[model samples]
Each structure stands twice: as C-alpha cells, then as structure tokens.
Target: MNIKEKYELSSRYETAKKDYEKWGIDVDKALDILKDIKISIHCWQGDDVTGFEANNQELSGGIAATGNYPGKARNAEELRKDLDKALSLIPGKHKVNLHAIYAETDGKFVDRDELKPEHFANWVKWAKENGLGLDFNPTIFSHEKAADNLTLSSPNKEIRDFWIRHAIASRKIGEYFGKELGQTCLTNLWIPDGYKDIPADRLGPRKRLKDSLEEIFSVEIDKKYNLDAVESKVFGIGAESYTVGSSEFYINFVNKNNLVPLLDTGHYHPTEVVSDKLSAMTLFNDKVALHVSRPVRWDSDHVVIFDDELKEIAKEIVRNDSLDKIIIGLDYFDASINRIAAWTIGSRNMIKALLSALLIPNDYLRKLQDDGNFTERLALMEEFKTYPLGDIWNYYCAKNNVPVGEEWIKEVKKYEEEVLNNRK
Candidate 1:
C-alpha cells in the first residue's frame, strides 16, 4: 500500500471552540493546509490491554493483566455505550486500536475460558456500526495469567521461556485478527516483547524476535490492509531498558523479514540523538510509519507537547515527501488529564508539526541539504518553529459547535505554561 493507504492520518479533538480559541484554526483551512493529505480522526480511546487503571486503547497488551475494565465498565454493553459516546463526539471517519482487555479478558480467546464469542461479536459490531476500523494487537491471548518477571538473565528459566513463547503467540494473534476481521479492519502491532536486560540472557532470543516478525509478515492477504509494528521503548527502569539500538538495527530487522517498522518519537528521546532518529526513519522511509508524542526524562509517551527540535526532524521527513508515510496518533494518557484530551492534543500537535515543516520554503530546504546540515537547518526553520497547524483544526471544531470549555482551556494553558517555564 502507498503512504496514504498506510498512514491514513488522524487525531483527537475534544471540542471545536477549544481547538479554535487555542489556535484560531478550522477544518477547511486545516484541510487546505493539508491538501492532498489523507487524515482520519479517532472514534474513541480503546481500553488499555494491561488492566492498568483507565485503559486507553492506544496500545493493547497492558489491560489484559488486570482482567477487568479500568473504567469500571461492567460488560461489553457498557463498553459499547462508552465507545458510542466517543463516536458521537467525533461523528465521522474513524481510526482506532483494540485494548488489551479484548485480548485477555473479554471472553473471546480459547486460552481464556471466560471469553464469549458473542461478546466479541457485539464489540466488533459496535465498532462497525460507527464506521471505525479495528487496530488489532493479538497478544491479548497471553494475558490468560500474569507474566512472571522475565529478563534475558533472570534466575528463572521459566521467565525466559515465557518471553519466547509470548513473542510467537503475539504474531499468531495478529494473523488471527487479520483473518477474523477480514477486510473490515486494519492492524498495528506494537510489540511489548523486548528483553528487560542485556543480550546474555539467551543471546539467542534475538533470533526468536526475528521468528516473530516472520510469522506476522508471512500472513496471506487478498485486499489492501495496513500492518505496522511499532518499535516501542520504555524509560526510567534500568532493568527494563534493553530493547532498541541503532536505526540500522531496526532497518536490518524489518528488511530481513520484509515488514514495516514504526518509529515512536518518544522512544528515541532518552537515547539516540534526535538527528539519528530522522536518519533511522530515512533508512526505513519506504516502510516507515511515524508514532508521535512528547518525551520526559526516562518517562515516555507523555502528553502532546511540541518540541521545536523534534519538529525539525519531522519537517525534513515531510518536506522530503515522507509525510504521507506517517500515521500520527497520540502516545499519551493520564489519570489527571481527561483521556479524550490526550488524543485530541497529541493528534492536533502532530498535524501542526507536519504543516509547520511543510511551510518552509523549498529554497532554504535545498540549502540545508547541500550544506550537510539539513537536520540542524530544519530544526532552525522559522515557519516550523512558529506555524500553528492547529489553528484551523481548532476552528473547525468550534464551527461545528463542538464544546471547548473554559476549564479545558485552563488545563491547556497550564500545560503550555509548565512547558515554557521548564525551558527557562
């Protein structure tokens, strides 16, 4: 599939007025700004697969561990009700990923005895009714029980065995989703499968990782469908810090199996300089799909806070005509921040970043390319540094009469203030 088919852009906007007031932007203007660009917005946040409190379906495995809806939702019906609320809020083309709950606890898997096929059907039906496509992650099958803490070097051989098995299982799950969903869905697999320590644990597990990709890539398909595997990294915990090396490693791995690799912007923040992040993307440009979000020291997938430096890297990606290769989604969530806001802000910011990058004059960009300082010059580009991609995005929501309340403004203002003060 082409970049438009693969990325099919999207974001979350809580309300029109808030979007407009914040940036005085609108949908048509946003559309004109992004002319010929393919964009899709959210139907709603999916549940967290890990069972962590308040599951946001941005990624799928975490909610399954808890075996209950983090939203305290009682059944598939209630889940539908909540999702319906989200759908109504947006009222158009939809893009969504499945939650970990559906994989592990929603009564659909053979390994999890509690799953009922009817419940699963109802969930899919609800999504289809609203015109939203499923972003599937199959590892929900592994949540049948809690995972024993496993690292490559953990004392227990069982933990090592579990990781290997889980990797294989995740691929199978993706294949299953492809079959079950038929042409009605799209899948993005962000594997949480990575070593928590150095390579010595089995040293051979990297081989297992390759085997996992092979399984997913080998799937048979008859129609256009998007399959993306996100290379995600966790920060803060040293023991959990092993996965991801050079961009070369990512390209080599995906190229070996003929699978696409997703670049989560935050994953590179704590290590791998920003310029390398772009180079990593360039190496896999044909197979790249950018995952956008802010970085906190060691903490990741933070709220959609735009960084000029990060935008510079992204701008070059866009100006070089790779923007079409990106499907921007929010990699953020918070107990304190309204979940919907996280989606809207992160998505809006990503669109803004792309436009800001595109607004730069071609003459200047060519100079950077010639100077061998393209990345740095892109970073210093004035338009990308100041353009408001969200002005029209914010305005369109208000024109449609979507509510953008004062409190929401207060929260966003606070966020801006905090971000600015930190730079000082």
Candidate 2:
C-alpha cells in the first residue's frame, strides 16, 4: 500500500484496538498467536489434483476437479513456484501436503508400493529452505488397482496387499519429512472403498479394511516424527450406496488405536456440521486433524468462504482451547478459478474467522451461560459480530507485509497476465 493507504489503515487499527479493548481483548496478543498457527496448504489444488506420474490416468475414486482453468501446473517445479507466489501473498507460517502420485521419479515409472523418501527429496529440500513443513498421503485411487473403487478393503488379496505396501511406504515418507524438517508430519489415510449398489454383505468390506489398517500401522515409526490420521467419507461420486469407512467406523477405530481422527468438512452429510464434532473429538482425543473445506450439497469440494459454519468452527477451536490440539489444513480443489487465488482466499478466510473468535470475550460468555443469563449472552454474541473485524484484519495484513484487503487481487491478475497466460 501507498503511504496514504498505510496511514489510513493505522488510524483504523487504533480505533479497532480501542473497541476490542472494551471486551478485554488484546489485538496484538491475538495476532501473535495467529502468527504461530500454520495451515497445511495442499499441493493438489494448484494442478487440479493431477500429479507428475509417468502414466496418464483419468481421475478416479470419486475425486473430480471441475473446470478447465488455464495454466494448471504441469510439473512439480511449476506447482512449487505457484505455491511460493501464493505463500508470499498469504501471511503467517504454512506447510505443504502431497499425495503419493506427486513423487518425482524423473520420468521413470515408480509405482506407489515402491515409493521412497528419495522421490520426495526435492520437496524436503524446498521445504527446509522455505522453513516449511511437509505432509503426505498414499494415493490409493486413480490407478488400475483401484479400478473397482475397492482398495485396502478389497477381497482380492493382491490389490489390498499392493495398497498396504503403499501405505507403509507413505508413512515412512512422512517420517522422513518430519525427521528432516524438525516438525511432525501428519500422514493421513483416506480410501474410497465402498459399493455403488447395495452390497449383499457390508460387514465383509469393513472387516477387511480393519485388518488392512492393522497391518499398515503395524510398522510403526516414532510419533515424534510422524503422526497417523484416518479420514472417512459419507458418500462419493460412485459410492452412493454405502461407505465402508463411515464416521462411526473411523471414530471407533481412532479411539481404539489411540490415533488422530482426521475430519473433512466435505466428508459428511449435508445437515451434519464438523463444528459440532470438534468439542466431542478434542474432549476425548489428545489431537485431531481437520481438512476444512466448503461442501455444496454432497462433497463438491467448493472453495471455502467466510460462511457461518467456518466461523462456528473457529469459535469451537478457540473456545475449547483446542488450537494446539487440532491440525488444520485446506482440502478443496476449485479448478474453476485461479488456483493460487483460491488458496489465498480460503486461507485468509480461515485466519479471519480465527481472529474474530479470538476477539470474543469467551470467558464472560461462559460465565453468563453458567449463571443462566442466556438473554444477555446472546445479546453480546450478536453485538460482537458487527465489531471492526475488517479494520483489524486489514491491519494484520499490513503488519504481515502482505497486501491489505483487495490489493492482492491486482497482483494475482498481473501474475496471470504475465505468467499464467503463457502456459498452454
């Protein structure tokens, strides 16, 4: 921003600081806490979930990114370049998440089962240079083995065994990331193992899945280097009849095995909100993983907005004092627009919601609830909604040296004109 704009922003921040002070809110403290929070940005979003594997395969396993947006990253270099640009625009620390298919095999075909930490050497090197962390997932779909959409739970021992090896390899890679980067890397497992039509026996698939997980987690690495999490989907493109890894299934498994439960906002039914489950999960588990996204209808994986659900999710995390217990990550791939802009928008919104939650007088609200003063509690909650959130947010962007408000939009447009437009 120019001198005049920066001066105006400083003035607004002074006023906002005073307003929040009335509620005993220290804006500077909130910003300090926010600076320490890192959101794991997914690599798939930049390339529409397309990886640089030698084999050309269509998207499968109920995953799809709509729209043929131009300038999608065609290689790992381009994806990292795009992420570098996006991260420069976004404030605070962050991490990058990768799938098995993103392994850099140098034009050679490397199956998931044979994947090794060597394949992701460049990723680790790039992350270390940028002072970022890395996460991993086994690409359990979009392959010939998953042609039937049954992996890990397939009755075919060959298919299941192959994926089991893949999972084992993935965990080792996660451990490598954490060990090399001096940060814990979350390795999440999400399989699209379900039936499109009503299956005669539902228990069979679930049992197989459990047995497979037992074997996968058997080769345990130190929790300090790598953490394991499991994710379940309510339904997907082809698996409408039933999902073997339902919420109850994974919840029970996580509790039983002392593993972190990864909850995806797009992995539930329409009426079900992940915000409601935060308290319950954090209450029982020491840590939980979150894949925050916007779901339109059923798991469309739409771009996240500053919607009510996002705000509530933020409030739950802050109110329960679970920020340290929760691992937050973005999981949407909206190919309909500029991919880098999508990352900036979603990450900024999540940060904004968290900041808004921090500004609330939660102690007073809880006291009112305890004293049965529901009327006043509701009044104060509603009143805080109209507080100078924008001013505070703009000031945060300015302090972080990122473009304030819509100013970043112009930079994105300029990059598109000069860089993105050049790609065929």
Candidate 3:
C-alpha cells in the first residue's frame, strides 16, 4: 500500500482500538492470540477433492464436487502450488489437512492400507520449509471396496478390515507429521459407511463400526505426536436413510475411548447447529475439534462466509475461553469458483470471526445473562454489530503483510493469468 493508505489504516486502527477499549477489549492482544491460532486448511479444496492415487475411480460414497472449474490442480505439485498461493493470500501461518489419497506415490499404485510416511516425505519437507503443520485423514470412500457405500461398518469382514487398516495407517502418518513438525497432528476419521435406504439391521453396522474403531485405536500413538478424533455425519447424498457413524454413535464412542470429538458444522440435522454444541463439547472433552463448513440446505461443503452461525461458533471458542481447547479446521470443497479465491475467502472469514469474537465484552455479557438483564443484553448485542470490526480486520491483514481489503483480488487475478489460466 502507498504511504497515504498506510497512514489511513493506522489512523482507523487507532479509532477502532478506542471503540473496542470502551468494552475493555484489547485489540493488540486479540491479534497476538489470533496469530498463534492456526486453522487447518484442507488440501482437497485445491484439487476439488481429487488426490494423487493412481488410476483413481469416480468420486463415490455419497460425496461430489459439483463444478467443472477450469484449471483444477491435476497433480500433487500443482495442488501444492495452489495451496501455497492460497496460504500466501491468507494471513497467518497455518496447517494443511490432507487425505490418504493425497499421498504422492510417484505414479505407483499404493493402496490406502499400505501408505507410509515415506509417501509424504516431500510434503513434510515442503511443510517444514513453509513452517506449516500437517493433519491427515484416511480415504474411506470413493474406492472399489466402498462401491456399496460401506467401509468400516461393512458387514463383510474383509472390506471392514481393509478400512480399519487404512485408519490405523492414517493415525501413524499423522503421528509422523507431529513428530517431524513438533505440532500434534489430528487424525480424524469420518467413515462413510451407511445405507441409502432404511436399514433392516442398524445395530449390525454400528457393532461392526465399534469393533473397527476399537481395533484401530488399540495401536495407540503418543498424544504429543498425534491426537485422534472421530467425525460423524447425519447423512451424505446416498446415505440419507441411515448413517452408520451417526452423531450419537461417535459421541458415545469418543467419550468412552477418551478421544477428541470432531463436530462438522455441516454434519447435523437441518435445525441443528454446531455453534450450540461447542460449549458442551469443550466443557466435557479436553479438546474438541471442529470442521468449519457452510452447508447450503445440506452437507454441500460450500465456501464459508461471515454468517451468524460462523460468528456464534467463534464466540463459543473465544467467549468460553476455549481457544486452546478447540482444534479448528476448514472443510469445504467448492469447484464452482476460483479455488484459491475460495480458500482465501473462507479462511479470512474464519480469522475475521475470531477477531470479532475477541473484540466482544464476553465477560460482561455473561454477567448480564446471569443477572437476567435480557433487554440490555439484547440491546448491546445488536448494537455491537455495527462496531468498527472492519477497520481492525484491515489493520490485521496489513500487519500480517497480506493484501488489505480487495487488494488480494489483484494477487489472485495475477496468479490466474500467470499460472492457473495455463493449466490445460
């Protein structure tokens, strides 16, 4: 930015700081804490959920990336390049979440169960250079074994065992990332084992899923190296009637097993919201993980926006003082737009939400709640909506050396012209 723009940003930031200080909020402290908080950016978005698995089959198991956006990443290097571009546009150093399919096997056909740390050696090296940590998930869907829309919960022992092994390997890979990067990697399992129609035997699949998880968790890794989390879904496209890994099942399982529970914002009933679940989860579990997503009428994994629920979710993390107790990650794959722009928008919105949350006078608001001052509470809550959040946000972006306001658009356009438009 030019000197005039820099002077204006500084002046506005000062005025914004005064606005927040009226509520006894520390703008500098909030930005400091925000810098330390890392959101795991999912790698699948760059490639539209396509991975490097050789001779990959159609993306099955009830999930689909709807758009055929031009210049999608075709290989691991290109995906990494896309991710690098996205990260540069976004402020703060963050982690990258990967699926087993993202393993770089160099054109060799390596099954999920056989994946090892060596396959991700290049990723680890790149992450080290970029100062990013890595998170992983086992690819339990979009495979021949999962053609019937069942995996860990399959009645067939062979198919179930295959997924169980894959899950086991995924945890190990996550551990490797943690050990190598000095940050605990979360290995989350979101099994896509469910039925399209009403099941004759719901308990049968639950029993099998429980058994598979038990076996996978039996070979434990150090928590300092890796932590485990289980994500449950209400339903995917084909699994509308019954989701074997339902919310109740995974909650009970994770609670019993002492593993972290991951709440996907998109994986709940139409009336349900994950923002409402965070307080209880953080209160009960040592750490609760979150897949921050935007569901358009379903688990569509649309790009996240600065919506009410997004702000509420951030409030739960900040107001509850559970920022350190919650693991946050962005999980959405939208092929309808420029993928880098999608990543930048969603990630910046997340950070913006957190910053907005930090600027709230949460302690006083809670006191108002406890004192039963409903009218004033409601009044102040609505009043704060017009607070100078954008000023501080622009300052934060500028401070982090990122493009402030619409300036990032120029960078994205430049990359599209120089790199993406040529990816034929």
Give the TM-score of each candidate.
0.64, 0.99, 0.99
Per-residue CA lDDT of model 3 for 1-424, tens digit only, reads 9999999999999998998998899899999999999999999999888888897878888788999888889998999999999999898999999999999898999998999999999999999999999999998888999977888888789998898889999999999999999999999998777888988999988998899999999997999999999999999888989999999998899999999999999999879999999988877899999999999999999999999999999999999989899999999999999999999999999999999999999999999999999999999999999999999999999999999998999999999999999999
Query: How good is model 1 by TM-score?
Result: 0.64
Question: What's the distance in Å from true for residue 5, model 1?
Answer: 37
Candidate 2: tens digits of C-alpha lDDT, residues 165-259: 99999999999999999999999999998999998999999999999999999997999999999998998877899899999999999999989
Error of 2 at 267 (Å): 0.9
49-131: candidate 1 lDDT, tens digit per residue: 23221232233222112222224223445435544543334313445555334532433233322223343455456555765
> Between 1 and 2, whose TM-score is larger?
2
Leading candidate by lDDT: 2
Superior by TM-score: candidate 1 or candidate 3: 3
lDDT of every model, 2 decimals: 0.45, 0.93, 0.93
